[model samples]
Target: MKKTMLLCALLMSAFAAHAQESRQDVSISATGTFSPTIHGATGTYTNTDTSLGALVSYRYLLTPRSGLEANYSFTQNTPRYVVPGTSDNNVHLRQQEFSGAYVYTMTFKRYNPFVEGGVGAMFFSPIKDFQTTQLDVKRTTVLGGLFGAGVAYELSPSFDIRAEYRGFLGKTPNLGHEAFTTNRYRVLSMPTLGIAYHF
Candidate 1:
């Protein structure tokens, strides 16, 4: 038992020494959300509005090149349903995302390029106003996968400018109504640019 404990302690000490110094960063980004049009298998189609959004992220580094990031993004989206001969109507949705990602970074001089992938929960709340048809529609939340690729250009020891393309993969929300059903999984693309601050 003594030998086993010693070995375990030694291994843990080695691992701790091998880990890089911890670093943390916070970033705020101006983003654009663009969703694809889904053509259903049953002669129905759904299209989402392209809108402006914001992304806030916090990252903690466990190693020099590997870390984890938590992100929150918000936007307003309008999805319209077209059923070939009826009146076209749209649902104004307030969209929010809560996600976490494993980030792997590569550094080249003052430039750091990174890739991230993870899971997210998408919350969509529809505004039942004059633009929205009164149905049995309510709020809904969908789980999805999220990914990003980006590059950061260091300006100083404490600041960097970041540009990234992020995407979310999920099923189209129906807002609890059959008219909004597309039965399709699609991606929402976001192009982001922002600045990060480090301490």
Candidate 2:
């Protein structure tokens, strides 16, 4: 009981700190990610597919240290596949995600470190030129989770350079008619470098 109460008190304190930082401010940032794609069958295997993408986020600061963030990302990868009788082919997959998250910032003398997490939905589209038809899969409102640490070097009060490493987790249904299962869970690791501006 005591341990649980202490945990609750700590959470309350964090919330209070966030509330205190909510004030009128705006910030915009861009990020790039490189993530690998994996395919699952009787077992799981790496597809040897790597993706590169960029995202832009807008934050409405409720306080100096906390805010609400709206982010969108676009990425693409090509997976090479081989079957016993069929010719080897490459399948192209593109993804887009939109999320809303809570962001907390901590500034040091010349660097600022922050943690961010969020949840949202993702859309996946697979374009296989060798196939007669394209595969488009839409996962409805899938849960998204992100955790990252970033360093920002302030060039000015409103503009700065930031670098971060973040990981993304989500799932989408596989649209291949031949597959017995309909769901595929996606996990990615992304490192981003970009500039940010505060208003």
Candidate 3:
């Protein structure tokens, strides 16, 4: 009876040690984002410029294959009217988003792939220059959703390099609130490259 009890205790200790070794609790990452032009409200404003942005994220592991992540991103672009005779007038459109997601990861040696989905809120503001005669632009807050997938390569026990593609869905922002209010939905695609540290 004593021998059986001793073996049970040793097995339990080994299992605990193995569980600890396989667990990764937390991770932080910094990323660069690229967003393409988006058209709004009967092509009233067609943003033709590609933009650069930045994102920072924190993730907490709930299991070996799943976790919760929160992230924030900032993006800015210049948009112009689609009319051919329109003068060269450009306005700065800035966006900031705060989000949380559920992340699922699959691992194979040094390679890890993940998929995430979440909901969030975004703030959109338009900045006009002194010479601009456009209507006053107001900062608007709207609800948004995101879906993304990524792959990560483990460089060390606590470091990784990652690449991800995320798509954001939200209402088309009406900065000027002109005559037309189409209330349409718009999508923004952002691809990011980053490095992460795990602890």
In terms of lDDT, the best-performing candidate is 1
Better of 1 and 3 by lDDT: 1
Q: Which ranges in model 1 have alpha carbons more than 4 Å from their true place?
A: 1-22
TM-scores of the candidates in the order shown: 0.86, 0.69, 0.76
Between prediction 1 and prediction 2, the one with superior lDDT is 1
Model 1 TM-score is 0.86
Cα-lDDT of candidate 3? 0.72
Which ranges in model 3 have alpha carbons more than 4 Å from their true place? 1-45, 83-89, 130-135
Span of 10 residues, lowest total lDDT, candidate 3: 25-34
**Candidate 2 lDDT over residue span 78-136, tens digit each:** 54444335454445666677888888988787687888888776665665554413343
Sort every candidate by lDDT, greatest first: 1, 3, 2
Candidate 2 vs candidate 3: the TM-score winner is 3
Q: Which one wins by TM-score: 1 or 3?
A: 1
Clashes of each: 0, 5, 0
Scored by TM-score, the top model is 1
Candidate scoring better on lDDT of 2 and 3: 3
